[model samples]
Target chain A: MKRNIRLLIEYDGGRYRGWQKQGKNADADTIQGRLEQVLSRMTGEDVQLIGSGRTDAGVHALGQVANFHTDCGMSCGEIRDYLTRYLPADIGILKVSDAGERFHSRLNAAEKTYCYRIAVPGVPHVFDRKYLWHFPEPLDMKKMEQAADFLTGRHDFKGFSSIKRTKKSTVRELYAIDIEKKEKEILISFTGNGFLHNMVRILTGTLVEIGCGRKQPEDVLTVLQTKDRQDAGMTAPPQGLFLVSVKY
Target chain B: MKRNIRLLIEYDGGRYRGWQKQGKNADADTIQGRLEQVLSRMTGEDVQLIGSGRTDAGVHALGQVANFHTDCGMSCGEIRDYLTRYLPADIGILKVSDAGERFHSRLNAAEKTYCYRIAVPGVPHVFDRKYLWHFPEPLDMKKMEQAADFLTGRHDFKGFSSIKRTKKSTVRELYAIDIEKKEKEILISFTGNGFLHNMVRILTGTLVEIGCGRKQPEDVLTVLQTKDRQDAGMTAPPQGLFLVSVKY
Candidate 1:
């Protein structure tokens, strides 16, 4: 009997080459490749795992969702144990459930959330340095929030992404952009129906530029109007970005 | 003229061989060794860094204080910059000050606090997994607190340590042992005048055994009374322990 299994994965992607199983070092470098290998070995059948999206290298995930089809009769609990026993410490399976045949992780996803952590000035990067981007300069919250206001709407985010797609629309629904500062860290969260390639990071970088006085709050509108990637600020590095969740 | 300097240090301690600069590996392996190397190059002098105390190889520290004597004319700010630029990412210098010649990191410390982090059942080990000790079984907090009660107070804690010391007094003042559970994590905090070799880990282990029903809460008193290491529970691993702070 064929079974469609859904998994909630958490990973410290500092070492992996993102979510896809590509390149010459597939099995060793990619999360999907590693999962497929273990699943194939456990079930004695090749596994095709589908990820909702591809996170860049060095990006972390607290609630990454993926689905796979297998003919194995092992219970979800048993499979979880098998994977937990074999997978490295950096990756963890938070939940495993047998979602029926019609569930597709990528197609069924309605919204996604990503959080970017910035260690503000006067803070020392110590133990968890891998997950934070140290921005030494103090930022103006009012300016960043103003820029965020212009960014949270349905718009052509082509100017805020690296992709130059002709066949598909670059329009995306950005539901919310929340900027919260706690102690020495600034957490910027984004909830959107979908994000174009490098869109969230570029949007973060653009807001940061406005916060640090390099750009004005109204520049977001200009970028959206121009629909050119050059108008956007530099893409924030992958180390500070985290895929928070994929919601159906 | 020798200038006495004090440093506030923070480190991950996952890859180093404790705080001391020893063994043939020397500069490449230990936290103190690495600091000494950077300080030597910056000041053109062989620096001797005295830590508050030695932490085990895998133990982390958020406020491990240290002091050194140097003839370098560099300002504290310049010295901090030099160390920050030269030291690796995992080790951070939170502060540098010119302490008086009478000050000693190990001698002037009046109190010390250590924290142990345990991830309880249903929690996933992901990015910060290096710092947490994962115990799958649910812990009995009331039992652990009972054991903490028996362990607190001024007593000879020889049985809760791996050391065999006869020259020095084995008795020490254990001011408090506070255990708090938050979500899926439990933090066990210990404050005292001083601790022995493997004492915190051993104490945590014994408390855990009591919490898990492997030992009685009153067994801590037995271990202290007998003054035998064998009467205590197993020594916990080093990764979960943190040198939270040292008071002057």
Candidate 2:
């Protein structure tokens, strides 16, 4: 009999391609691949790890969730300790416990919160270089906040994504967009039901452009209505993005 | 004619062999070596970059002070931009400014502050792995504070350092030791007039040992009076230490 196990995970994605494992004959350095490899070894059986969502290359996660089925009789405490001790330094297992049979990581996630960090102009970042977007130019916070207003609430975000075509609905509920200024960096966090491909990055890019006076605060409205990808701004780099949490 | 230049620097010392450059023909991957290399090219002359002090390999710094002399005609802002743009991402030049000809980076410094970070027991630290010491054992804060009290104030700290013998007096003024408990980590900061080689790490090790009940809190007094390195617990790893600031 197989037991369902759920995991709370976190990782620095800078070294991996992304979360998903590309099949054989591809660059398969991925979070999922590493998890499956470690779990398979621990359980002495093949394991299929399921993640809540996929984060892009160079991105990071602080509270990612996953689940898997295993036939191993090891106690949850033993499994958690073994996994944490065996996993690479860059990957961490926050929690491991038995889950209900019907629980699914991806299907059950309710919302996600992602944060983007921009180094404040004229500031130096060394230890945080891999975790920040070192944008040196001064930005207008008021303008950025005004633009963020346009992105809040439910909308068709097809124009703000890289996906040229998708059979799935492009509609997503953007619950909130908060821009906060820390001592050395500006943090922008997005809480949403779900984000389309590159939607958060694109939205960040558009808001940044508006903050820098390259675009108007209201331009995001037209981009949303027309659903033209070209109307959106550039896609922000992945290094600055962190999946802060996934709520179920 | 030569002019004096002072630099406020920061670096992630994980990649380099510390702040001071080991002389030619040795491991030259040092923060000072990189700074001198860039400054030499920018000024069209061999530059000697003098840092406030040497941090061991794998240690980090946030406000390290340094100075150099050169005939380079570039403005301070230009020099700052050039150094920041040319240096590796791990090394950062926070500020560049003209200084009095008599100023010395090391001698003129008044006090220094260093911080050590330890991950809380059973917490996962992925993105912050390099910056934290992942000690899973529970630590007693009250015991650690008791140990710290014995180390505070003016004392000959010979036994707490790795050095066997030195003509320079081991007597130093330790102003304060602040232990803070954050959500996921415990931070200990030390402010002192000067620290001997391996002093901070050894002191941290001794304190940690006391915290874990390996040694009694009052045992630190014996370590201080005996002047024997073995009396100390252990030298904490370099990755957990950060040169927070050197104030003049």
Candidate 3:
């Protein structure tokens, strides 16, 4: 009998080559490979877990959802304990639960949220260096917010997506886009039906360009209208992006 | 003409061996080394910087202070700009000032504060994994506080000192010891005139042991009375410790 198990995992993507399996040597070690290894050991069988989405190398996630099928009758606590003990220190299983038979981590998700963090002018804080992008120049929050407003709502985001994106459709419904300024950090959060490959990064890059006065807020609409990748801003670094939550 | 310059330095202690010079690869690459490198580049001469104290390898600092004598007539802003342009991304100089000849980073300090962070049960947070010690067990705050109280005031913490410590006189004034629990993290702060080699780590080890019910709160007294290194608890890992501030 197969039982569906849902897991909320958190990981530092720095050590791995993104979330998927890759070629030999350094690339073979990834979040998915590690998960399968742990599952294989726990059930004495080969288990392949499906994740909600793939994150680029050096990208982090706080509430990434994954699901797997197993015949074990152990409680959710037991599964969580097993993974915690066997998994490397960088990856963790935050929660475990029995999922519905037809539930899918990726297909069943209603919305997703991501956050990009930038540390303003100062010594890069020793404690937070790993989790934030340090920028020495003082950014204009009001300008960034104005650009953010232009990105909200449903639109074809082909201009912001990577060229490698193979998805059939480039359209995504952006529910909200918020730009918040903390003491020394600027947090840009996005909630949307889905994101194209590197869409958030490109969006952040364009907004940052706007904040720095290199581009105007109205340029965002122009870039969207152009639907050309070269017209979009540079892609932000992966370290600054975080998968905050996946809503089911 | 020599000018006394004060620097607020920040570093990620992981890559470096420690804050002091060591022999070969085992030695610390050091925050001091990096600072001297930048200074030497600015002025075509060797530069030596004196820090408030040494933080062992893997230990981080937010307000670590350093002072150097330089012949360059550059103002604080100029020096800051030069370092910001030349320094590596991981290390930064937050502030720079011309200090009086009598000012010293180490000797003029009124108090030094250090924070030791411990992550409670559950998954290791990817963002804070490098900066905290993950402890899976539930800790007793009351017991830990009781043990912490015994450490306050002036005492010869010979038992807590590492065997490698060369300081003949071990008597030091401990102004305060505070234990704070926030969410799933425990922060233990220590303020003192000076700390022995591995003093804070060993003290934290004993406190944690007490919190875990392995040792009584009064056991700290017995450990201090014996003045024997073997009588104390294990030294906590270095990553969990941070040089929080240095008051002048």
A142-166: candidate 3 lDDT, tens digit per residue: 8888888888999999999885556
> Which structure among the candidates has the greatest DockQ?
2
Show model 2 residue runs off by greater than 4 Å: A1-3, A24-28, A70-78, A97-100, A213-219, B1-3, B24-28, B70-76, B213-219
Taking every candidate in turn, the Cα RMSD to the unseen true structure, in Å, is 3.1, 3.0, 2.8
Which candidate number maximizes lDDT?
A: 1
DockQ of predicted candidate 2: 0.59
Report the interface RMSD that candidate 2 achieves against the true structure, in angstroms.
Answer: 1.7
The DockQ of each candidate is 0.57, 0.59, 0.48
Lowest lDDT block of 10, candidate 2 chain A: A20-29
Per-model chain A TM: 0.97, 0.97, 0.95
Judge the docking of candidate 2 as incorrect, acceptable, medium or high: medium
Cα lDDT for residue A22, model 2?
A: 85
Chain B TM-score per candidate, please. 0.97, 0.98, 0.94
Of the two candidates 2 and 3, the one with more favorable lDDT, higher being better, is 2
Give the higher-DockQ candidate: 1 or 3. 1
What is the TM-score of model 3 when looking only at chain B?
0.94
